[model samples]
Target: MEAKVILIIVTTGLIWLIQLSSVEATQWHSKQLLPYFRRIKLDKTKNSVYQHTVKDAIRMHLRIPLMQKALCLPKGTKVSKHLQYADVSFALIILKSHCFHCVLQLSSDCLNRMVDKARQHENKFYARFTYACKTHAEYSSDCMESGRPMYYRNLRNLVKQTEKCWKL
Candidate 1:
């Protein structure tokens, strides 16, 4: 009986080892086949062109004018007055959430490029604008009472810190 039990245990162990080896072999075969099934790599020039195309598409889609409308502010309206509107706060919150998601979809390289473009246009306001919208969206009443300019400057500084932390 003792001998029989030992034989049974040995048989089970061998079976497990065989199954493990078969799984490893299958994985090795799949690894060998991967390159054939994968997408072909683009040259650096082509890749950069594609990246720029995508970034421009995102920028066009996420233009600040669209966000301004969402915040219920007309194109020529003063930001201070618009900030006081009850709907402005709600819109800003929604815009901030949407921008957070949109930005996440973009690569850090793309964001850096966008920042560079904004700088070249003397539009340092882009980052500050987004930050202010998000901050006021969060604390609408308090932000209005305390002052929009102060919050905007503070948020802009925060945006600068965040940009500094991003990988180049």
Candidate 2:
């Protein structure tokens, strides 16, 4: 009889402990960003919409940040590699791939020329030449691929995403 009573008390205590744990779990909510990209820019400028746009682009792509052993990385990362020696990153590419969604506030034609010039200076920098319909038709079949941007059918959708994301 005593053994039975002890068992019952232990079971009751276990159940109560489980309930307490669940209650504690509910209070432990936290923000979730994948791969944990910590922003590295040291700039303190708060008035630039361009900076906000870049942040919005990162959010849209949902890119996993550079975790440990994230990606060995190629010598050339992207067109922006020419502009900046630092690798542009997969997160940045997936985020910034859209012409209309470009956070840099640069036109397709202008940016393309800038990329090409940069390539002239350093072959290591020229990574990719994205096909924008408004430009790059003369040298690329991709411009004629589907009456859309070379990467995705997403010209309109990209523009829409950019427009909607502008407020963020």
Candidate 3:
């Protein structure tokens, strides 16, 4: 009788533990996953302005490398030398090969050009937004007097957009 009683108690304890774990897991999913998926959906719909800005910035950015190549500086020459001279060359080689597999990787020339273009785009976007904010703040009264609140609304939107861009 005592053996049967202990067996029942053990089974009940195990069931209770399993139920508690499942409840915790559900709570975690609701707290973490819901916001992540919602943000992704929001990001997709609202990215048009950023997309156009990035595209223009990238286009202008790509020209610099073409100009450099035209000027006769061979690509990868400086980077290869720098990598070879660095003390972490072996570790870097292993990491590069492991992560990128080398086969589908961009050539050093192309990678550098793309990185530069991205940097330029980021700078340009920041500058454009900053200038807009400054200009609007200086002439806010003009905007208010123009018989349309469009400029103030635009300025508010610009501030919000700038915040989003900076987060990027």
Candidate 4:
């Protein structure tokens, strides 16, 4: 009986090991078959042009020029012109921030004016405005009100929430 139990355990262990090895082998084969490259192939005329991802491009745009200059890229690397668009909606009264627990109370009329100001302008590459909300506690006030531009945090959670006494 002891030998039978030992044999069963060993057999199960071997089967698991074999399955794991086969999975690793399959992953290796798949990676070799479809390798991912940071630099994708562009048109034949501009063979070596690699475009930065939108998020990275945004970061590079927002960052200081000295930091941007420190990083070197291929001679013709371009920021991807393709932009992702979203129609974001915020509540009329309470504003919930993504992090740092910042909440702003505003009236509906005031919120409408704020939204009007946030509208994208024609011929402008970027909008130059942001909304400011007060933090719940003194601890998160620093993050809510940073020296850097509002785009640095980018209002991670720009959603509406219902709280005690808020507007807009």
Candidate 5:
């Protein structure tokens, strides 16, 4: 009876090892048949191009020189048409910026370009803007009084909360 129990234990161990090896072999064979090229082709040929197209559609009418300069880095030529378009974009941004925090947080250079464009117009909408960290404790007194522009801490959920507030 002792010998029989030992044999059963040994058999079970061998069966587990064999199953593990089979799984490894199947993975190797499947990987060999597919190759990495198939996965890369899908990302570059599909998703990347799709993202580029969407970006193109959104920037259609904006004639931004700084944006054109950034885009033309590899192209080695100057684009002239965007200068006029940038001005138009600036006016629209200032009008909408009265209530959008994302617009306020854009880089200094982008804001400069937008302001330059805005200078050409009468700034009728009065773009009230402010900054915030993630914590809600840093509210600006002006923002609270007007119930307009507000600040926040740089917390991860800030964008979500901002979107929620703006939606209302």
Candidate 6:
């Protein structure tokens, strides 16, 4: 009887610990973004909608989990070197989900140019990671202002858990 009681207590304790850890994991994104949040330059001269839209977009991109490891990289780790092992398709996923959402709206020439740029800057891993988010924010704000459904579509497709993207 005593042994069974002890077993139940241990099980309960383990369950509580697991739950606490899960909660911490969810908060990790917010914690990591604190620095960026503090550094945001809110232009008082701009309209409230414009300020909010850009800020929101920046927040959303900075919080992406897959890119977190790359964004807040380890001390002394070179992002370009780190990215050699990273699945390059993550960039594609972002570009496809955001910049290429409305394929019909983009001219073949424009699409080719963007694709060429992404490919051309393959070695610029950290820049690509950080720039993609900042760039997305700017583009996102435009779509939001223009009332393009592309912004909503991009939100829905933002994070697809592919083997390539999820693989660490």
Error of 5 at 25 (Å): 0.8
Runs with alpha carbons beyond 4 Å of true place in candidate 4: 36-40, 44-168
lDDT by residue (tens digit), candidate 4, 50-155: 1122234233432211111111112233422321111011110111211112223334443343233222110011212112323333223343234124443331
Worst 10 residues of 2 by lDDT: 64-73
lDDT of 6 by residue, 1-168 (tens): 999999999999987666544434323432433343344455476456645654454344322332333232233322232232132333333332223111112123432332333223221322223344453554345434443233423432332321123323
Q: Which scores greater on TM-score, model 1 or model 2?
A: 1
In the predicted model 4, the residue pairs found to clash are: 92-168, 93-167, 93-168, 98-157, 106-167
**Among all windows of ten consecutive residues in candidate 4, which has the lowest summed lDDT?**
85-94
lDDT of 6 at 56: 51
lDDT of 2: 0.30
Runs of candidate 2 exceeding 4 Å displacement: 1-16, 19-47, 59-168
Q: How many clashes does the backbone of model 3 have?
A: 0
Best-to-worst order by lDDT is 1, 6, 3, 5, 2, 4
Model 5, runs deviating above 4 Å: 34-168
TM-score of 4: 0.24
lDDT of 4 at 33: 19
- lDDT per prediction? 0.37, 0.30, 0.35, 0.28, 0.31, 0.37
lDDT of 2 at 32: 15
Looking at candidate 3, what is the lDDT of residue 100?
A: 25
Candidate 1: residue 89 lDDT (0-100): 46
- Estimate candidate 5's alpha-carbon lDDT, on a 0 to 1 scale: 0.31
What is candidate 2's lDDT per residue for 122-160, written digit by digit as tens? 221111122234555432444333332222222223334
- Of the candidates shown, which would achieve the greatest TM-score relative to the real structure? 6
